[model samples]
Target: MLLPRTFEALPELPKGKQIQVDFGELKVKNSEGKTVKLYVIVFVLSHSRYKYTEWQEHPFTTRDVLRCHENAMEYYGGMTEEYVYDQDKLMTVSENGGDIIFTDEFQAYKQDRGFRVYLCRKADPESKGKVENAVKFVKYNFGKNRVFHNIESWNEQCLAWLKRKGNYQVHNTIKKRPIEVFALEKPHLREVSAPLSFESNLGSSITRIYCN
Candidate 1:
């Protein structure tokens, strides 16, 4: 993939910036009523490359997305200045006149945590390349050939694997590990005591719900 001339140079850490979030998924079996396994959505952070993958038994919804972000922030212990996602209807209720109408719970979560949200422009995948790359990397490495006996145990294993692979792996752009860059960014980032203890309005029990 040829990068635009604008990205020819490496990106610098922006002031008051923490990192970005991306959505990803992995295939899993719905033993309750499955003819076969299906894809389970996962969220990843672009800066630390720290990830929180979960199995969604129901159709992905607004609450599911917020819960995912809440969990991710707790797992990382900080918040990003902005969230970048391709225009998915669940998170984005509507868009008009440069204003994005996000879901009620989503707005509450963002307001409570203090971050901005930006939807990727239509048909412009290049705008969020870093997150796209991270998703692909996660699927290929962690999702491949994985038989999850239990999502809880599997997630623990995944987190361990992510720490080893994401934290330690040398980043191509900066030729440094993600954890290294993240460590440098953390001291400058606004510290949050923890994420709010919000129950899943959708009513599913996420093993690692963000109560941090």
Candidate 2:
């Protein structure tokens, strides 16, 4: 029988040690009064709780995820020693017992960046609570009742919101503003030697995987 899930308080992590990444989706009406879904991805600094988010008109492929990873790193001005992720199909092909088989593209990307990864099952509350909260926060607090103007405008609004509210507000758990905490966390983050670029067939997947 499956045991009941428990949410243990997450301990404070070392500065620049790890970041958690998660993806979610929300629906909004476009300029033409049509409903559309946006794919949202977020990355959070484990120590400071600093956050970076991106929205796309298309579902993310492995290459798209790679590029977004680079973007998130640059947004933070660096990367961390490790990344925590859910068992996303974009990265992981399969898992058995404690072993995980990652997608080919993701395997190479991780090796090229030289960072460690810790993945957990979706039901692992202790592991997913933070990021899952972030996703819900974005969906309800920001995306809810918000009109979809365009990808660029939506992203701009998201960035502004992060600065105005998301990272600036005093966190409920830590009792400190994330931006303030990030001042100390930034120095501990690992530097990115070079930005990653994918092109031609390796670039973003503009069309949905099953899109006509």
Candidate 3:
């Protein structure tokens, strides 16, 4: 018999503001004509559709994932009070009845950051549909849209396009352009502890798998 899904329905935001984060992996070939994998975990603020994406070459543990969020928050200039995610093994320990036991690493990450983590139930992908859609959008639009001379260069180009195309575009969900929403969100964001800069440890967290 199929197992029963137990995750709760996500509650709507009170003031038409929400954000979602999720991880995804894509396969591509490298310059030498070999297969490779790319891991990109992205964050999108719902009302504004302001987006951030990070790419690495390794299976991220919980700590690595949280760092990705921190980078994204730094990019966005503030953290959302809640994040919607799938039931990844890195995040959750167990689900008994309607109760979810978050993994120690994931729980600690949430506590440190101060946000509620909502998990999509097993077999219930729609709970985090925005992120799921964003993942597919990145893969087909960003991943397959063009050929790259190098992965790093491709990623830089991707970030540029993501800001121009993804972040600046008007979202069907909110009917407001991301940049416009971002302007509004900016005033509400918490002050940054430090200026945004590339994190060094992200390089060690991923392995390169290239496809030709």
User: Which one is best on TM-score?
Assistant: 2
Local accuracy of candidate 2 as per-residue lDDT tens digits, 1-212: 99533342589889999888889999888878899999999888878888889999999888878888988988899999989898999999998787999988788789888999999888775885667677777777889888898899999999999999999999777789999999999988898876767544844323222223
TM-score of each: 0.76, 0.89, 0.77
lDDT of 1 by residue, 96-130 (tens): 89788886667766777778777786466655666
| lDDT of residue 166 for candidate 2 | 93
- With candidate 3 superimposed using the best TM-score fit, by how many Å does residue 158's alpha carbon deviate from the native? 2.0
Model 1 clash number: 0
Error at 29, model 3, angstroms: 2.5
Cα RMSDs of all predictions?
Answer: 5.1, 6.4, 7.9
Steric clashes per prediction: 0, 0, 16
lDDT of 3 by residue, 85-202 (tens): 8777878888899898887756765665567777776467667666767777787788873544566786788789787887777776677787887887766665434322223455
Select the stronger candidate by lDDT from 1 and 3: 3
Worst 10 residues of 3 by lDDT: 203-212
CA lDDT scores, all candidates in order: 0.62, 0.84, 0.69
In candidate 2, stretches whose alpha carbon ends up further than 4 angstroms from where it belongs are: 1-8, 202-212
Model 2: pairs clashing at backbone N, Cα or C within 3 Å:
none
Which residue pairs clash in candidate 1? none
Report the Cα lDDT for candidate 2. 0.84
